[model samples]
Target: MQPAVVAHRGASAHAAEHTLAAYDLAIAQGADALECDVRLTRDGHLVCVHDRRVDRTTNAKGVVSTLSLAELSLLDYGGEIGVLTLDALLGLAADHGVPLFVETKHPVRYGGQVEARLVELLATRGLARPSTKEESPVVVMSFSTLAVRRVRALAPRLPTVLLLTQLWPTLRDGTLPPWADHTGPSVAMLRRDPEYVARAADHGHATYTWTVDDPADVELCAGIGVRWLATNAPAATRATLAR
Candidate 1:
């Protein structure tokens, strides 16, 4: 089977990352899944923003947790797009019938409240747990083992992905943390150790390689039997893999 094409921060290469416009473009491009980074504002509203501070992606400064949702709405992302709420993003995904890969941003002021609130939000939408894999449309991912574990505790049926930036002792064998249902590795890590993919598969773990915008990297991932390919260029990646 062809690997599922997951859009990283929507079709971010063509539009502002995490904006509704980007997500709409990703759906139109036929991405199998949409990925987003989740952060909590000071007033406890979950938002779809990648950076700790809005300065990088928006026209404002200061940490996400230091600003209220209303305060965040005043800033412009990429000068034209406004900040997107997690709730609004979910609605867009639901409307398009595309699955969501939610990445919980780390070092937030909220201790474990991020996961808790995420679970609550999904539960409210009747999406926290699904009776079958096809029925589930959301997956929680994080670089923090603790964060993923928290998701497992609160929403047992929700799939959890452990994102890897660098090889750690616990994951040297291509196994994930106990609570993680899948593994997400950076493209560089997979390129550095091609065998890691097979090792992970041997351990019954599904490997998803991220931010693969290059054609060669896409070929490498397809050759390694990765189950998911997260990329900014989903249309091109899907076409290349189809061949």
Candidate 2:
């Protein structure tokens, strides 16, 4: 089967990253899954923002955690879809029957509270756990091992992804930590070692790659058997893979 096309930050190449407009457009374009980075605000709320600060995505300047959700809402994100929250995003995904890949930003002041809040939020929405890994619509991903483990501990039946930026022999041999159900490698790593896709599969691990926007990379990923293709151009990638 062709790889699932997961939208990274919601068709971010065409619209502001993490904006509702971008996500809506992505789903409309037939993206299979949505990926977002979430950060905890000062009030302990999880907001779907990639950066620690809002300076890049917004006109106003302030650390995301330093500002309250109400304060962030007033800032101009070029127009509508100001500071989208995880709760609102979950609702949108539920409405469309789409899956979400939630990345909890690490090295934050909140520490493990981020994962705790996520677990609580998911549980509140009746999605804390599923009967099986494949049945879960929400997937937790993180670069920090501790963060992913925290998610596993908080919600035993939930699926988690461990994002990899660097490649080593053990991982190249398809050895992943027990806590992670899937492995996320950067597009560069996949290009550097295409064998990793099949290798991961040998160990019963599905490989997901992030931010793949190039056509050649898309072909390479699909050709190498990547299970999930994360990209800023999901619609385009899906069409290319179909061909």
Candidate 3:
């Protein structure tokens, strides 16, 4: 079977990362799904930005949560590069009939804002759905277990992916990390331990790794039975999977 390919930040390698343009390119290349990081603006709107601050991706200089969506929109998010909002990204996904895998960044600081807004958006747009055990699509993933759990509560039908960088001693801990009191284990440790994957599966959640860019790492993840591999280089990873 062909491993599913998710476009990390929407074909970020060719276009500006996290912009609508990047996402469109990824879809044009026949990607199965689109991935994005969600952050809250000052006015409590969900935006498609990876960094906590806009300095790197935009012309603005402030925390994303501190700026209103109106302020953020005016800041040339596409300044010489890529820029997009959660709404725009979702709209594109809907138009292309592609699935979305949204990751909530800095869930600790944003509290329930990101999840709440996401639920509202999906509900309003009629994008939320229940995935079968064999064909779960449109997943919501996060390093924060709490965020994932919150999403589950808000929309039980929607599938969730637990993003990790390390392993935890307990399955419940997978929902919250020690640093942020958020749940979820690390993908790094799961790659090294089969038991970790089993534990995550037992909790009714799928495992996915992030920022994976190496062929060997992709092979290792595939060997470990991870359902998703989030990578910056989707085309290269897809080629590796083809082999």
Candidate 4:
């Protein structure tokens, strides 16, 4: 099977990251899915953002949960890039016939607001129904297991992927790391230990790795049978996988 090419934060290379323009461009470039990082606004609205503070990505300074949606809307989320809300993103994905893989950025800080709102949004978009396979494709993912679990509880049919990094610790005595307790399994660990991937698959979860920029790394992930590949250079990653 062809590996699914997920545009990291949309076609972030060409357009402003996470903006409608970037997402549209990603679809135009033949991406299988679009990836987004979600955070909660002060007023409980879910917005697409990568950082805890908006300074890096937006023309604002402050925590995302501290600002209301109305206030956040005033700031340029893409900075010189373009800004797009979660709703706008989902709509665009639906219209263009692409799937959306949403990653919750700081679930502990935002509580369950992001997952709850995402579930609601997906349901409203008719994506919650398993009967319709092509209306709007969506999958909620996160480094936080709590966030992923919340999404699974709300929408069991929706596939969830666990993002991984190498820094996480192993479970020697059934004791998980502070971050691992919150996140599903680590994709990096999965690469290091095939048993980790087997355990995750046994639990019915898909695995995905993030920010993969190296061509060799992309090929390695494909060889491992990872379901999703989140990369900054989608075109390059896709090319590498094709090889």
Would you list the rank order by TM-score, best first? 2, 1, 3, 4
RMSD of 1: 1.3
Give a tens-digit lDDT track for model 4, residues 1-243: 555788999888777787777777788777888999888777777778888888887876888778888887787755443346788888888787788888888644668877888888778877875554233387767776687677777876776665556434454222333322122334455456645544545544445666666776677667766667777677777778777
Tell me which of candidates 1 and 3 scores higher on TM-score.
Answer: 1
How far in Å is the alpha carbon of 45 misplaced in model 2? 0.6
Point to the candidate with the largest lDDT.
Answer: 2
State candidate 1's TM-score. 0.96
Better of 1 and 4 by TM-score: 1
Q: In candidate 3, what residue range of length 10 has the lowest lDDT sum? A: 176-185
lDDT tens readout by residue for model 3, 83-132: 46788777888788877888888644779878888888888776565445
| Model 4 TM-score relative to the real fold | 0.81
List TM-score per model, in order: 0.96, 0.98, 0.82, 0.81
Candidate 2 lDDT by residue in tens digits, 53-83 = 8988898888988898888888877576468
- The candidate with the higher lDDT, 1 or 2, is 2
lDDT of 1 at 228: 87
For 1-243, candidate 1 gives per-residue lDDT tens digits of: 668999999999998999888888899999999999999999999999998888899876888999998898888998555579999989999998989999999977897999999999999999987996446899899998899889999988998889998888878887876788788889999999988988898888888889899999999999998988999988899889888
lDDT of 2 at 240: 91
Runs of candidate 4 with Cα error greater than 4 angstroms are 78-82, 132-136, 166-191, 194-205
Q: What is the lDDT of residue 167 in candidate 2?
A: 74
